[model samples]
Target: MASFFRSAVSPSSHPSPQQAAAAAVAAAGDAAVKNLSSTFRLPFASLWSQSAAPLSGQRAAAQAAAAAQAAALAHKEAAAAAVHASRQSTYNTLFTILAVVATILITEQVLYRRKKAHLPGPTWTIPIIGKFADSLRPSLEKYQAGWNSGPLSVASVFHIFIVIASSNEHTRRILNSPMYAEPCLVASAKTVLCADNWVFLNGKAHVDYRRGLNTLFTRQALATYLTIQEKIYRSYFAKWLADPSPAPTPYMMHFRDLNMETSLRVFCGDYIPDEGAKQISDSYWLITVALELVNFPFAFPGTKVYKAIQARKLTMKWFEHTARESKKRMAAGEEVTCLTDAWVKAMIDAREGSDKLADESRKVLVRDFTDREIAMVLLSFLFASQDAMSSAVTYLFQHMADRPEILRKVREEQYRIRGADLDAPLTLEQVDDMEYTKMTVKESLRVKPPVIMVPYVARKPFPIDPSYTAPKGSMVIPSFWNSLHDPNVYPEPELLRPERWMEGKDSPAELNPKNYLVFGSGPHYCIGQQYALIHLTAVLGTASVLMNWEHEITPLSEQVE
Candidate 1:
């Protein structure tokens, strides 16, 4: 049988059924091995071929091995190519990012230098943040150095280019030329005060708005506010005297509280409760802190701007409520008490064509302002007056305390004006009679003007001078310190000599009205100049007679901060 099978399987011969079936099975196994090798491209295909059909499958196995080896080599080459391409892509991405950063940095430097152009500032700014660290902790000495650098010095903070006007002529030009510039308090003013605040208004809108509100500071209104001011002053003086702390404590914040309370009572009367006033006063410092020349732009959580915004919202809520109540009270024919009452009464008279509208210019239009509008106006007054008045009072006390002779003169004048009736209700006549006190306040303001500089924005390319044109959208700051402290204007600007103001019209300070920028100049000058003067005069005059305190000179006494 074996011999027959071999013969049958031998060269192309027909065989018996069993031998044919065996050969067919072997052929099928070899075919399967070839198929598997081609489909899987596996390295073990040769071993499979040998196991499936060892006799006639040698050549098939060899072919399968060659095919599998070729397939493996191709896959290896493809993987290597993929790795090379991936590495190249990563390197290209890194290079592109680096190039973009470098280009931005270069452009920033180039633009800064171009805008700076022949000004006194750093030759090359410290990249994007540019004097940001210096700004964070601004110092009077540093500011003086910059102002002394040149008439028109330059600086960049967070890409906001600044042109500081140190000379009196240049400063006044920037302030008076509203056509080329307008008040832009600081980077964070609009954010803290709201963009639509009246203080932010420009051109005709600001003028008209200011005109309508001028009556709030009229002589009549000042008289009314005086009564409220005296009561607040007496109340605070009592509290200060009652303090049990034997050791000298810093009264800076106490003076701030006094000013805030006085301002609140004068602005809104009893509309704001004690707790509310305290809350507003505490939060107001955040607003002051955030008013830096340049601040972190975003109002992120825990940031100064964010805290100030929250404080503003809280304060505005009370102010708006006060407005609504004032309107109702004025409509009911109640006696005017605060500035809001006076304003609301004016509006009512203007609407009714009442004979009380004595001055046509003081009369409001037929259109009535909403509570929010009224509140915003009141907020503006507080913002404009609060810190400045606080500084005036604190320094006034300190200056007088430091110089006993000055304090003695102030007391003598207070006694002469009131004529031994220290507790008498303060009147406009009494406030006016305190001329020495007024000069003291003015001199205090001059020696340490609460507002050292007023920041403005160039509405266009401001030709601040023939040599230098401040670029459009740049900050053009008018510094009052240099002008107020100019040795040329006042021979001894550093000394707190109130008699300088008493020298009448020919005095250097009086002759150069431009130099006395205590209340600023131009259309945007402090509208409440008279009101502020009167307020300070009344507080100091009253304190001179009614209370006595001393300033203990500590190491930090002279520190401006």
Candidate 2:
């Protein structure tokens, strides 16, 4: 058994032929199997490992694709949500804005209607800026329509409610009721004239300040102003005669220049140089233009109010300097020559107890005003008198030229007063004695009053009548045109008849002093009433004597601007 096992185990050992053949076949079969196993082992293992790796990579790619898809879906959902929220927020904001605007507009109308009350204005105001367009280009026809609407017609401008008083009684009430209202002038008056100007002072302050100024318009002061005025009138009249223009020209501006020079000389004397006077005269029209009923409220550059402010500054410079110089000369005991000198001397006399004052009623506790204060007062005077006086003088000349009969009578009266010596100086007594000349001035002023209305502001709720109460902060305007032109007050009111003043005690005009609102009425009535009359009388009287000019009637001669 041991031998047989050795033979089977050792193939290389010798054996029988049959056994060897069998062993060879078996060995060959075993060798083939071993070769096949050796060849396929590494290839199958590599295929299995490579296939397993690809499968693992494919699995990783599938997981990554699933994660990317999920991220993309989340991003899309977030974008849609963000868009929805954004749309919601926009709608909310727009709705809020619309609601607020609607509320404001509704509130505006409600407030306007409440303030309008029962007055005779438009049924509904022109939203925000009512009547602003009409104010920009004011016309007499429109004003008349408004006045004819009712005695207390209502209107609004820039949300500011306005009440217009057209009847004589209502106009006078607004003027006299100091407890309820005070002079507001126009919307721009406070800005053009400084807010702190003495003219804007109210109540006792205004009274006290005005009391001290009465001395400047007395009879003695008028005589002094008249001398200076006469020199200017003569100079201007001589220049007018010397002009080489053969054709008729517009002398309105020339008259304005003449008036400006007269006013400056009367107010400042030689203290304002000729060049300075010309500069102020040339620039004064800016102030006039800026003082319209309505203007841009601010003093921005290149605006009318701005230009007027610059002009005011320039004028005040010279005026303040004049005040300083006049104070020095007055303290040195010089004769009073100008308004500034008169004021300074009055202050000095009041301090020294001099009895030169006209009366006790005119006397007041005078204070030493600063140069700026004195300058401001003079500026107020110029602001008050310049334009009105210019218009008066221009119309006086035109009226005299148009009606030679009137001119003949004026000339006759002038000659009768001065007795062929036209070059002689004038006096207040002489001015007073020319009753016909005074009547002409009064009629001229009545026909075309320089100021048609005065504006006042309500300090509190004013019971203007038993029916309607003027709201606080509202503008109350008193129109003089209707009252002055009332047919009952002056029959045929459109006609310019100086004889109406000469009609004596029972004359319609003489019986009703309230209708004469040319210079205004009540506490704020023109303080220079006597001075204005005297000035106009003297100017007309002088012109009637010194020179003669003709009026060339155009189609526009009878038209009122």
Candidate 3:
């Protein structure tokens, strides 16, 4: 079984400010409740136990007992009358509540069937939270079991109907059919990624916005980002070599920090300080935890959603500041240094003559975006890629550590291209020339894919196939695993075999292009796929040359959580 590397990084290692605060409060509340409940219960129990004890003096006790019995009979009669009235009232309230709940459930069931007509799914969903208990502790095997049931399976959470596409045909159809579906992440996604972020755009708006932003991740753009990325990689690798852990500790967080620093430097560069990058990198874990496939919708105080919102505010504040500074420098005719500067230059170049801006397919290339808007776009990119990339980075290390032969292959290619010049900067040609490194990265992603599924919401009646219709407004998730691991498409799909990618047309992997849904498909597919691949290849290549990491094997390491 496989797992989403997003949550695969343990949150226990890096505790966010909000998470710490919430834990402290919960602990205090539990202690107080425990003391108060014991204080009340102990005294009440003692009084009840001693109530029937015998009186000390026999003669006085007889007279007193006779009087007490008469008084007790009167009290009992009065209490019985009151108890009867209270019981009647409580029973009536219970009946009313149960009736209301039954009515709602019945209506929900009716609507579910109406929408589900002819589809393959459950006979009836669990009242309010279908499959939620299982969700609390999820597994890839559990998900795969559902997928194996049929091409499509349905479930509901908080009354929100969900349709999962398990078959390659159904999954690809959902992914490619943007006219009928659009990305609809969990209820809390808007809170974390921001509502107006370009990621949430649909149809033509999404396509148009994506077109303008695609310039930020082009090969040329990646070339520009490479210098900064290589520098960051070296810095982090140096830090890892200096780690204080006595034994092999989980390096997932170390990899995460590297990814965050790389992204921060690549996106904002000199506009952000070293301290700023470290702070954001440490704080980003809360956002990752909050963006899980499911989360409590309301951002109540002390909730993961609330902590993530706070983290987002901090990250965006820095991003917006960087955008402003980049705009100022670019307008003043300064040289482009980082991604922000690169983006600002792109906007400026779009106004200039036909060099890079001459692409006529762009409807609006030169449009000015506000500082907040620019920051939001950067935030969206981070939101979409960070945890997934972190996963890749972690697995990249583990895979390379376990297989020195492949690592040797990657190293050979790196050295061949760089020509023993360790100090020389990484160039785009070097990155592209490392074909074996690219294959290694690709195979790692396939074996331990960063993202498992992309959640899309149906916009209209989607005739996904002749047999079933995807209901409007329901979540239609296109699972990537089924296609990526199709036995016919990838012989020994579970094995970490990079050669499969280069085995020519006779290779199942090369011929089955559709099976490689690594970046997804259609309109909402990852716009940064090439940038991600090149970045991973370069980082792994550099690591192979610079450092040696030994992956510690644990029983649970191979099991997906």
Best by TM-score: 2
Say which prediction, candidate 1 or candidate 2, comes out ahead on TM-score. Answer: 2
Report lDDT per candidate.
Answer: 0.87, 0.88, 0.84
lDDT ranking of the models: 2, 1, 3
Q: After superposition, how far is residue 196 of candidate 3 from its true place, in Å?
A: 1.1
What's the lDDT of the predicted structure labeled candidate 2? 0.88
lDDT of 3 by residue, 106-138 (tens): 998998888767666778878888667777888
Q: Which stretches of candidate 2 lie over 4 Å from their true place?
A: 1-91, 358-365, 554-561
TM-score of each candidate? 0.87, 0.89, 0.82
- Give one digit per residue, the lDDT tens place, for model 1 in 71-138: 99999999999999999999999999999999998998999999999988999888889889998788
lDDT of 2 by residue, 1-561 (tens): 334544674766667887777767777777787888889898999999989998999999999999999999999999999999999999999999999988977887888889888889988888788899999878778898999998999998988899999998899999999889999987778888899999998888888788888888878888999999999999999998998988999988998888889889999999999899988998879999998878786789999989999899999999999999999999999999998899889989887778886454235535688899999999999988998888888888888898889889998999998986777788878888999989999998988887788889999999998899999999999999998899998999988889999898899999998899998887888888887888899988898888889999998676555
Q: Which candidate achieves the best lDDT against the true structure? A: 2
Give lDDT: candidate 2, residue 153.
94
The 10 consecutive residues of candidate 2 with the worst lDDT sum are: 358-367
